[model samples]
Target chain A: MVRPGGRSARVQASVHAAVRELEAEVGREALTVPLVATRAGVTPSTIYRRWGDLQELLSDVAVERLRPETAPEDKGSLRSDLEAWAEQFLEEMSAPTGRAYIRDALLGGPDGTNAGQCSAYAAEQIDVILDRAADREENAPDVETVLDRVVAPMMYRILFRPEGLDTAYARQLAVGLVGSNDR
Target chain B: MVRPGGRSARVQASVHAAVRELEAEVGREALTVPLVATRAGVTPSTIYRRWGDLQELLSDVAVERLRPETAPEDKGSLRSDLEAWAEQFLEEMSAPTGRAYIRDALLGGPDGTNAGQCSAYAAEQIDVILDRAADREENAPDVETVLDRVVAPMMYRILFRPEGLDTAYARQLAVGLVGSNDR
Candidate 1:
């Protein structure tokens, strides 16, 4: 997507791309402002002046990259809709890049930087599903409830445990949250 | 708890204490093996040989510190028992030191060093509660189920959000997991 802007927008885009590429190659731990500056064809001073620190740059990158590229299509039922959304989410988050993005977003800080934006994006997806369900006379759980019951647990295990998330796990969570086995 | 051992065990204990103190003082991000070695009155070479890296040393300290000092006492029923356990667990984890321990434990690695041990310890707590409920002819959800439905969500928010955990949250989780409000 090309942004209709001048030199400032071009530099911002370049920096964002550099951060993502560097993060993927060396992992989040190894990424540095100097390295990003080199990769983005900008000076270290520019990066420092624009973002203040690596954490803030990471927060910006995470906020941009972690948001769903497109909204999930509304499936017929709450169960199917939730499962589909979760499956897509899990798939995205299972990749090394996605995982790194989420880790930065989540473990960043209490400051309303990346984590808050990322969470709000996630909550919007849940709201889309719940709103669709309400239209079908289905009593869907609230966004926080669904997040607590399904999304948080899946992400918890994925981040902390060796076990990977799968479709079956997503289905089970959907059933658990919705209190129904109907597919 | 004193472990009856020679020079190696004593060194390990001192190093662990130093790690905890340093973590509490400077937070985990600023902690280093050299600092810990200096504080513990050991050579940096010793730390390098035993723990391999700062992350590994952190994993060890976190595994040791994050485990419950004593198993939670079983209340009469599953609901009360779960609520009691969760409240205590949340209280411990809400502290800065405890939160640091948990962050180290959870975000430590995919290496299965600290995360595996920490998860096992948590599973054991769940087992104790379930076993007690079984003795009273009451049904209890499996460890994974309870973790998915209750503990994971709590931990996720604790780590990611600024919101602190409380008894009300614990009670709601207990009720949600057990599928009943009956005590």
Candidate 2:
């Protein structure tokens, strides 16, 4: 539901808190509109009016939780920074909790807004790395290219065939992109 | 439901027909077990017993539809063959219906069986191309590498950011895999 300005942060905060508590107590699958409303001491219509549905609310909450906690670690060279970031991304995104968040982010929206937001987060980090290389007069591909070559494959592996993934694989993707044998 | 041998092909055929018709008539979002059961002339319990839920049943139908209709076209060289196959794969998978099928195959179950089956179809085609290169005694990477470098990224792009994907992008992925530079 689109408000004239935006949703009230106060309501959002309490609802989100209720969702987290209910998710912990009863898990994600069992969450319902009435359950969340009762926990938050609001009517079910409040949730429906604000979020449209449970999946939408869940996606909103997941997107909030998935916001990057810190900037990508600086590891000197472009390749090293990308490799380190890629490794960390794979590690976190392949964990059970990370996997669930990814699913929640994607499966909640048919419009692709949440999924696109997640991708944008990765792109912002990639751009920071690219900007660093530019500052250092080092050659680095654009953010989209890195996303296509390095991050995309890793995400596919994470979401599907995760058996062959490792930090070495992450480093290999960075090397393929940079094309230097100095690793 | 796990039968002594397997589910009856007749029941499956009728149920699939009902689902397809209902999907066309009411669309996927409006589908329900009762609606499908009434259409198929079967009890709702039968559907639950057989497929566990509407999503699982939808996934099963999608998997059947997603099976490759023909082998990867033979283009006289491994590079050409792979390029041709990758272009076709990307084209089909990025289309609206293809995207729906991929989503159906994935979003149904946490068990990953349906998604794994779809990946297997792609892997089987990749192996056929690999076998041809091996028969010609040319240098070639393994199926896993092709999957990692080529298909995985393409899938990620299809599922997320599909703006930059095209036949040229598909060919470039093929070139990256088989780098003779004679294309």
Candidate 3:
């Protein structure tokens, strides 16, 4: 059911909206192909044609929804750039959707299942931050280390523990991860 | 049914064997109070006497079967301590059973059903490493920082990623986290 030319603006909007609604209601699991098609009032074929498969569709939606907000505007120093990155990371985690995403990543599942998706997504995000840090000659460690030490713990505390994610904790992690990179 | 005092050593051994067999076959999901009692050749009441509920019995079995091995002799440095921890963490993630346990934690289902059980179990494991690190004044960073950076990341990586735990990546994290505290 491909539109004669390409997916119409309305069809794309409807598909995106369907994904958002499902994700909000029940995390990532509930967004099955049929469910999204039904919600979008489009044929399943339409979704398949546009997004290829469930994972691709979900990944696309996840990327759009979970994209880190505005990149840091050229902070003069590595420390300041990292501080900006940490603040942004904390802001993302504080949101309801961000918390849900973190829980899914942490407790997600085993290898070859959907469990790896969140961590992979997170690693990509860290790469972006690391690239920014690298531009300033900072000794930002590899993406995996950044994720394991800095991002995962914050998400874990927020999702599983009663202890809340606060500015103070975020700042501490910032100092430990970024400032300590060279020291 | 209360074992009329206490079960004979043979009876206790039989019960433990049954638990091990059931866990090995169908996993924790397939385990049931009645099935365990039947396999053990004991009355349900007898099983209840020893363990108050199915989950308790399962938890006991889990603790016995999946207990962490003793840490390696410390090399009097944070780097060695972290590497020892990383090796153990990788070993834990290598098992199908361990992966399933983590998957269950994430999808512990609605209503906050298994949340407390999962949280308490994870906290106990974390406490062991945290306490051990705390004893090493020369090598370990402050307790809170170690927990945040080193411990949390290891757990998160094991439970989430499909790839072999990145030992070099973890080594770098340990150095960065502990080295920063020295300054």
Candidate 4:
């Protein structure tokens, strides 16, 4: 769908795209507003006047791009639903673009501002899966419980550990969380 | 306990201590070899000859410092053992010295070298707890499973989320991992 508004919206899109592209190319640490402006075909003055500084610009870009690209789908059971959600979540998180956004948000963007947005986006997607699962079962684990048991561990490995995350890892995690509750 | 070796051992201990002190003071980003050498009362040439780079030096110091201070005690059951381990782990990790070591390991040190050492250290401690629990009960969850269920999420929150980690969080995590297997 076409984004609303005219020149200003176009500029925003261009700048955001440029920031992501540069992040992918150079990594977040090497990113600069002047470099981003040059890539977006916008002036440094416009970037500075609009975003204030590199941290704010990165935060805004992360908030925009780090959201789930597509809505999570509902599967019949909680196990299947969680697995599907986690698979998609892991896939997005492991991608270069997603990695760039997360790296910047965690490392460079202001305190919790951008990182919280990323966490919120994941939580929102997980909530959709959990809600669907609750309809089929007598009881469903709360979001915080699910987060602590499943999502947080997966995220920790993704960000810190050298172990690779795949659909199998996602399935195991989903099974661990959901299977334990079967009794 | 007195570490073995002669002048080399003393020099190594002094240099490691200086690196930890400076890291706690200014953080890893502001750390430099010359600064560390000066603080350690050693020449820059000695530092360069010994470690080659700041990352190498930090990794060595991190490896030496990040080890668990003492063996985790066996607490009869998996739940109590895990809770005790997590409590000590969280307390150490949240301390300024622990935070400095972790920060340097995660951010400034080489790719997997130092970070892997830190992870291995935690894994070793967790293994001891799990082994004791296993002797008490058949089919105890393995270290990997326990880590995914208990430790990963806690570490994610500690490193990324703004929330403080306390003994209560540790107890909850231990319970979640151990209590689920009671079917």
Which has the greatest DockQ? 2
lDDT per residue as tens, model 4, B63-166: 67887788798767777778788877777776666665665576544354666667788889888877776677744678777777677777766656646667
The DockQ of each candidate is 0.53, 0.65, 0.36, 0.45
Q: What is the TM-score of chain A in candidate 4?
A: 0.79
TM-score of 4: 0.78
Every candidate's lDDT: 0.79, 0.85, 0.63, 0.75
TM-score of each: 0.87, 0.91, 0.62, 0.78
The sequence of per-residue lDDT tens digits that candidate 4 reaches over residues A119-167 is 7887888888777776766367888777777778777766567566687
Instruction: Point to the candidate with the largest TM-score.
Output: 2
**Which regions of candidate 3 deviate over 4 angstroms?**
A1-16, A22-37, A42-64, A69-73, A104-117, A130-142, A159-162, A180-183, B1-23, B26-82, B109-139, B159-161, B164-183
Ranking of all candidate structures by their lDDT, best first: 2, 1, 4, 3
Clashing pairs in 2: B1-B50
Q: Between the candidate structures 1 and 2, which one is better when assessed by TM-score? A: 2
lDDT of 3 at A30: 64
Predicted structure with the largest lDDT when compared to the true one: 2
Candidate 1 per-residue lDDT, tens place, B1-183, comes to: 346697889999999999878877997778888899999999999999987888778877878978788877866888888888888777777777767777667556656457667667778898998898888888778899888877888776776654655768877888877846354
Model 1 TM-score relative to the real fold: 0.87
Interface RMSD of each: 2.4, 1.2, 3.1, 1.9
lDDT of 2 by residue, B1-183 (tens): 524444577678779899999999999889999899999988999999989999899999998888999989878788998899999999999888898898888876887777778889999999998898888887889898898778988898887777767889999989877968334
DockQ of 3: 0.36
Q: How many clashes show up in model 4?
A: 0
Give the Cα error of residue B101 in candidate 4, in Å: 3.7
- Cα misplacement distance, residue A37 of candidate 3 (Å): 4.2
